[model samples]
Target: MGVPLLAIVAWSGTGKTTLLQQVIPLLKARGIRTGLIKHTHHRMDIDTPGKDSYLLRKAGADQVIVASDQRWALMCETPDKPLGLTELTARMDHSALDLVLVEGFKDEPVAKIALWRRGVKGEVADLLDGYVIALASDKKLAIDYPLLDINHPLSVADFIENWLRTGQ
Candidate 1:
């Protein structure tokens, strides 16, 4: 697929994941295949500690690949060695899907929509720099692209769709 990757970035409480959950299926209904890459700053547990997969990870392998009848998961020892933003996009699968909706990687290559909920610390949005293609909030604001209400996810989703469709 030649469709470009897009990202939804926001602070802890700004609803990045929720927004993606709403928009992705909408895009899917229109025949857009989507995939997601999420980031976790804190330690996370996937495999049960006593499970075989957990044992393998404890054995110190740099990468762990697990597959089963209906699912698969990969755990990698990826450090802070991001090859910058653009290079990270190149490392993902872009050939078989319409879009890869990555979460986090705010410092990486692709353009992003910054979910700016009001009352959240400005420090959060401040980190995004110019990567913000649009801003979403529950309150109204005179943003340059389009001011969107956080509760009305439809408009935000539409914004993303129009951005991609018009080759913006």
Candidate 2:
């Protein structure tokens, strides 16, 4: 079977990352192997300037991989085309993971749980649209979707586990 994918989406400062940090460990405790993909709009460089890898990349190498005992990372310079969610997911090693939790890509066509907090700088009406299977929020709202407590990771994990089992 293909690796199951889900997204935790929200506006800025809604604790998407914080919830993932808790939920991942909880899922692991339940013997679920998880992979993660995070999307960012800002420009970022994993390699430092003046380093050998950076210098080689600056010289126009398309891809650079650095490996050591603890970890290995591959860096590719894509100046023209930014990779979409499908392309990024295709690059992951899916054989070992049961689920892939996407931290961003709110516009991607995937199953998602939207994190909503009161007084945050986003419209709840627009944020709730499209592929949002559930909502985890700090305060109760008058919506018909399944509501989850944003502070409770265990309950959220249970909800995710049920979704995985039933494919709902």
Candidate 3:
């Protein structure tokens, strides 16, 4: 079976990570194996400086793998090429996850739930443009889509579970 993917999209400071932090454990408690993908505009480093993996990459290794008994991580340096959502998701180990929750990549043409807040501009059009399947907000929004409470992660989790089950 193909891995189910959903994107959680919102403006900065809209608490996307906070909601995911709450929802991930709830999903895990239900025996759901979840995978997460976060997209950032700024540069991020998973390897620390002076570590062996870091040193190897600095010495011109294209890819570096750091493995241990507990876990393994692979870091690939792509200085010239930037990967899109499809390419990035394709690189994931799909067999290991029941669902893939994508945090950001708002323009990737995937199923998404948009977290909205009052005074946040430039995202209302996304809902109207049909890019967002559901709306989660702290304030009441009079729209024709599924509206969810941003404060209640359980309900949001329920919504996500239903979506995964029914493919709606």
Which candidate leads the pack in lDDT?
Answer: 2
TM-score per candidate: 0.83, 0.95, 0.94
RMSD of each: 2.6, 1.2, 1.4
Error of 1 at 1 (Å): 9.5
lDDT of 3: 0.88
**Candidate 3 on 3-71: residue-level lDDT in tens?**
878999998888899999999999999888999999998889999999888998999999988999999
Point out the worst 10-residue segment of candidate 3 by lDDT: 122-131
Q: Compose the digit string of candidate 2's lDDT tens values, residues 106-133.
A: 9888999999898889977777766999
Q: What TM-score does candidate 1 get on C-alpha atoms?
A: 0.83
User: Which of the two candidates, 1 or 2, achieves a greater TM-score against the reference?
Assistant: 2
Best by TM-score: 2
For candidate 3, the TM-score is 0.94
Please give, for residues 63-140, the per-residue lDDT of candidate 1 as tens digits.
788998997877766565634545555666677677777888777657777777767766543745676777777776
- Where model 3 places Cα greater than 4 Å from the true spot, the runs are 121-123, 126-128
lDDT of 1 at 76: 68
Cα misplacement distance, residue 91 of candidate 2 (Å): 0.4
